[model samples]
Target: MSTFKQGRYSRYLKPFSYLVDLSIINGAIFFFEINITNTYLFSLYISALWIIISFKNDFYEVQRYTKIVQVMTLILRQIGFFALILYTFIGVFKQPNISRLALGEYLLLVFLLVAFFKFFIFYLLNRYRAAFGGNLRNVVVIGDTEKSRQLINLFKKRLDFGYKFRKQFIIENDDFSLQKCFSYIAENKIDEIYASIAELSNKQINKLIDFADNNLKELKFIPDNKDIYAKKLKYEYYEYIPIISLRDIPLQVPINKFLKRLFDILLSLAVIVFLLSWLTPLLAILIRLESKGPIFFKQTRNGFNYSEFDCYKFRSMTPNKDAHLNQATKGDQRITILGKFIRKTSIDELPQFFNVLFGDMSVVGPRPHMVRHTNLYAEKVDKFMVRHFVKPGITGLAQVSGFRGEVETDKDIINRVKYDIFYIENWSLLLDIKITVQTFINAVKGDDKAY
Candidate 1:
C-alpha cells in the first residue's frame, strides 16, 4: 500500500517570511543612509513596531490560494503603517532636525525592496509547485456535497495550489462512522479535513474538531446557504436574486472564457486539418464495409445551458433502432469488430473536433449525455445540472479519470457527476491540456471501460 506524504516544512514558511521581511526593514535604514540622532535605538523601536503592525494587519498570513492582488494590498497597508510609525518616532523623540528627504527616501526604498521580495518568493513558490510537484498538503473531504466536491475539485485542478486530494467520506451514508474516518486520517497522515456544515450533527462536528486538533490537522467547513454571509461566502446579485458562491470559478470570468474558446478553436481546427482531414475519409470507407449506416453517428446530447445539440461521432455500431436509447455495453452484440477497435483507440470520437469548432462544445469540459440519459440523471443525481454550466466536451475529466463508457451501477454515474462538477468548478487552461494529453495516452493504452 502507498503512504500519503504530508508537507512537513510548510509550518516554517511563515516565520521564514517574517525573518526576511524584518531584515529588509532594518537593512534599508542603513542602506538608504537615513539621518537620525541615535540610529540603533530608532532601529530597535521600528523593528518592534513593525512586528506589532504586521500582526494587527494579519499581513503575514498568506494562504495557498491567496491572490497576487491581495498580496499587493497587504504590501500597501504595511507600508502605510510603517510610514505612520516613522513620523511618530520623530515626534516623540523631538528630532525635527533629521533630514526629511532622507527619511522619505528610506521609506520608499523599504517599500520597493519588500514588495519585490514578497512577489518574487510568491512567484517562485508557485513555479516550483507547478514544475516539480513539491510542497503539497494531503487533504480529505469529510462530506460529499456540491460545496465539498467543489473544494476537492479545486485541489485536483490547481496543482500549483499544492493540495493532494486523498478521499471524500460521505457522512450521510449508513456505514459511515467518525471512528473509521479518524482511523483513516491517522493511517494516511492527512493534513487537512473539510467537512460540510449541512451534513454533520452537533456531536459529530465537535468530535471532528477534537480529532483534528489532537492530530494537528487543519479543519475547515463548507458553508451552507444559511451560513453564506456569516462565513464570508462570495455574494453576487443575479437580477435581484441574491446568490452565494463557494469559490471563484476561473471560467466565469470573461477573459478566461475568451481564452478557452480561442484555444478550442485553434486546437479543433488543427486536428481537423492535420489528423481528421485524412483519417475521416479512410474511417468512412472502413465503417461502410462493416455496416449499412451513415458514416457519422449524430445524436442529441445536452450541451451548455440544458440546450440540446447534435453531437457527431464516427459510427461504430451496427444500424439499430435502439441506438439513441441504449448505451454501448461491454461485449454488446451490436458493436462490429471495427467498432471495438475504433472505440478502444478513441478514433470514433475524432469527429467531435468539428463539434468543438462549431462552438457547441469546448476542448475540455463535462461530457454531454444522451437526451434521455440527461433527463434521467438530472432527476436522479444530486448536482447533475451543474454540468450544463459550461459547454459539453468530446472528452472530459471524468473520461480521463476512468469514469468513461458504460455505467455499470449507480455508483458509476454518481462518481461521473462528482468529477464533472469538479471540472466545472475548477476549470483552468493547464487542467484542460493535462486532461487532453491523458486522454491520448489512455487511448493508445486502450481503456478497458472504452466499450
Candidate 2:
C-alpha cells in the first residue's frame, strides 16, 4: 500500500475516539439512573461542545509522535471545559433532574475511556511503524533559508514522525529551479514539499501549489520571519489554495463571537437598566455641581479593527482638547473633586455600559486606547495592532492585574500591551467571568493609579 494510504488510518482517530467515548458517557449516564429523556438535549449539547473544543484545540490533528501525557492533558482540558460549559448552561436555564451522580461518574468514565483508547491506538500505530515503515511520508524541502534547513534537521532527528526527506532543494544553488524540483519529485516517492515561501514569488507559490495538487503531493511553506509570528494561526483553504490570513483569534470564531455578543448584550442591558439607570442621573448631578463641563465625557478611542468610536465615561476630567493627547497623572489639577472620586473608584467608567449596550465595546477585552496612543503604541510595540482584533473593553486583563491608569514609562505600556495580547489569545467565558470578578474586587479595594 502507498504511504499516504497507510497513514490515512489515523485520520479517523479523532471522530472514532470521540464516538467511542461518547458511547461510554451515555452508558454511564444510563447506569446512573439519570433522566435521559430531558437530558437528551444535554447529550446533544455535549457532543456539539466536543466538536467545537476539538476543532479549536486541534484535538483532531493526527500527531502520532505526540506524548501520551500530552494527549491526556489535552483531553483533560477539553473535558474540563465541556463540564464547565454544560453545568453553566444547566444552571443558567435551571434544567431539572440532572444528578451529580450521573455527571460525575460519566465524566470520570469519559476521561478514562478516552485516555485508554488514545494510548492504545497510538501505541499500536507506533508498534506497526517499528515493525514496518507503513506510515512513513516521503517529503522534500525546497528552500535555502535557515528555517527550512532547521525543519529538515528536525525531521531527521524526530524519526517517529514518519517524515523522510527525498531531497533538500536549496534555492541559492546555481542549478536549483522549479523544473529541477519537479523533475526530482517525479523520480522519487515525494509525498510532501516544504518550501520557504517567503523566498518564492506569488507566481512560484501558486505554481508549486498546483503542481502538488495535480501530483497528489502536500505543499507546506516556511516563512522567512517565522519567529515574528504566532504558531496558533488558522490555515484557511480557499478553493484548494491555502491562505493563512492571521493568527487564530478565538473571538473571531463564529460560535465564540456570537456567544460573546449575546453575553455582552445580556449583561450590558442588565447593568444599564439596574446600575446606570439610577447611577447616571446621580453622577450627572454631582458632575454639574462640581465641574463646568458636560456631565458625560465622550472621547474617540480605537476599538475592534482600529475603528474609532465614542467611548463614554462620566466626564472624569475637565474637558480639554488635550484629553485625547495626554495621559492622566496623579494629582493632576484637571481632575475635579468628583472626577478624582469616580476615577479612583472606577465609577467614571460606569457610562461605558452604554457603549457595551450599543455594541461599541465588550464587558471584557483589551481596553481601547486613545487614537494618539494607538498610533504611538503601534509604532513602539510589535503585534500591538493585534489587540484591536477584538472589541475594546471598559475593564480588561491589564486593568484587573493592576496595569491600569497612567502610562508613565515604556515598561508600563509594554506590560499593558503584553497582558492585552495574552487576554485576546486566551479568551474564554470562564476567563471573562474571572476577570470581571477581579475587576469588581479591585474596584472595591481601589487602585493606586486611576488618577
Candidate 3:
C-alpha cells in the first residue's frame, strides 16, 4: 500500500501562495485607487518587486514543522523590506504627485491582508494534517538515545507536524549495521531518516548521507548536545526537540557582518578615546611599580577560521613560565597584588579593545583561548572549534553567563562551548546589546569565577 496519502498537495502550496498574494496586492491597488503616473507599469513593477522580496525573505517558504512565531517573523521582515523598496522607488523617480496617504493606506492594507491569509493557511493546514491525516511524511529513526526516542514520540504525538512514525532501528546489538538500515529504508519507502549521531561512526555516517542523498530522502540528526559536529548545520524545533541541518548563521550575512564590525569599530574607538587613553597610563604606573614585566600581555589565540592572532590584555600577573600552558585559577600565586583588583573588576581585559580596533576581535563573541589551551581543548572537548566560526570576543555569552575564567572541569568547557555555539548560530544586534549590558552588570556586581 502506498501510504503517501494526499500529501502531494504540498507541492502546490508555493504556487497557491503566489497566486493568492498577487491577487491580494493587485486587488488592493484597484480598491485603493492609489495614483500613479502609469498604472500598468507601476502595478507590474510593484508585483514583480513583491515576488522578489518574498523570495529574498523566504516569505512563502513555510515548512510543515515551522512555528507560528517564525511565520510572523517572516511576514514582518518581508513586508518591512518591501515597504522600504516601495518608498525608495517613489523617491528615485520623483513621484511627488503620488498621494503619500494613499500609499500608506495601501501598504497597511497589504500587510494586514497578507498576514491574515498566511495565518489562515497555516492554521487550516494544521487542522487538515491533524484531523484528516493529510500531508504526512513516513519516517524511520536509527537510534535509541533519549533524544531520538523523544523525537519518535513527537512524530506519533504531534499529528499537525505530519510525521508518520515508521520504525526505530536500534544499533546496540551485533546484528545491526548500515547495510541493514539501508535495506529497511529502501523496503519501507522512508521519506525521512532521523539518526542519532552518537550511535554511528564517521564512515557509517558518510555512507548514510550518501544513501539519503542518492535515495532522495531527507536526513536529520538528533545530536548529543555535548558533542559538536564540524559540518555547517542549522537548527529547527519540532515543538522543542531541536533538529540540525546545514546551519544558517546570521553573521554570515554581509549586512549583519557589516553592522557588527561597524558597531565594534565605533565602540572600541569610544573606549580607547574616553577610558583606555587615561586608564592605561595609571594602570601602567601601578603595574610597573608592583611588577617587573611589561604592562600589556600579548598571547597567541585562535580566531575565526582557526586563524592565529595576538590577543592583548593588561598584565594581570607577574612574569611566569606557565603563562601560556596554564590557566589562572581562583587563587593563583602568580597574580600580583594589583592583579587581584584589575582581574576582579575585569579591567585587565581593557587592552583587548585595541585588538577590537585592529579587527582581530569583536566586542561580543566567543572568548578566545590561548593557542596551547585551544589545541588541548580541541582534542579534549567536542565542538570546541565550533566557536571559531566567528571572531573571538573580549566578552561572550559564555563569559557573562558564568562560564568565564578557568576551566575547572570537562563539563564546564562543554557547557561553555554549548553557549558559544548558541550565540554564534543565533547572533543579532539586539542579542549583542543585551549581552553587553548583562556583562556590565556582572562586572559591577563582581563574579565568583572572575579570578
Number of the top-ranking candidate, with lDDT as the measure: 3
Alpha-carbon runs more than 4 Å astray in model 3 = 1-9, 246-451
Give TM per candidate: 0.50, 0.53, 0.52
In model 2, the worst 10-residue window by lDDT is: 1-10
lDDT of 2 by residue, 1-451 (tens): 1111112335466557768866765655665655445667767777777777776765655465566667777778877887787667557657676666666777777778777776787777777665676578788888777667777776776566677767888877888789888878867767668887777888988778656533445566776654555667545331223324333567866558767888888988998889998998998888888778899888889887566799988897877878878878888888888888898899989889889989889999989888888777776765566676689998899988878988888888889988988998889988888998899888888888867
Give the per-residue lDDT digits (tens) of candidate 3, residues 113-139: 999999999999999999999888889
**Candidate 1 structure quality by residue, lDDT tens digits, 247-310:** 4556866456767988999999999999998998898899999889899999989787667899
State the lDDT at 105 in candidate 2. 76
* Prediction RMSDs, each to the true structure: 19.1, 14.7, 14.5
Alpha-carbon local distance difference test for all models: 0.81, 0.74, 0.84
Clashing pairs in 3: 233-247, 234-245, 234-246, 234-247
Task: Tell me how far the alpha carbon of residue 115 in candidate 2 is from the true structure, in angstroms, after superposition.
Answer: 40
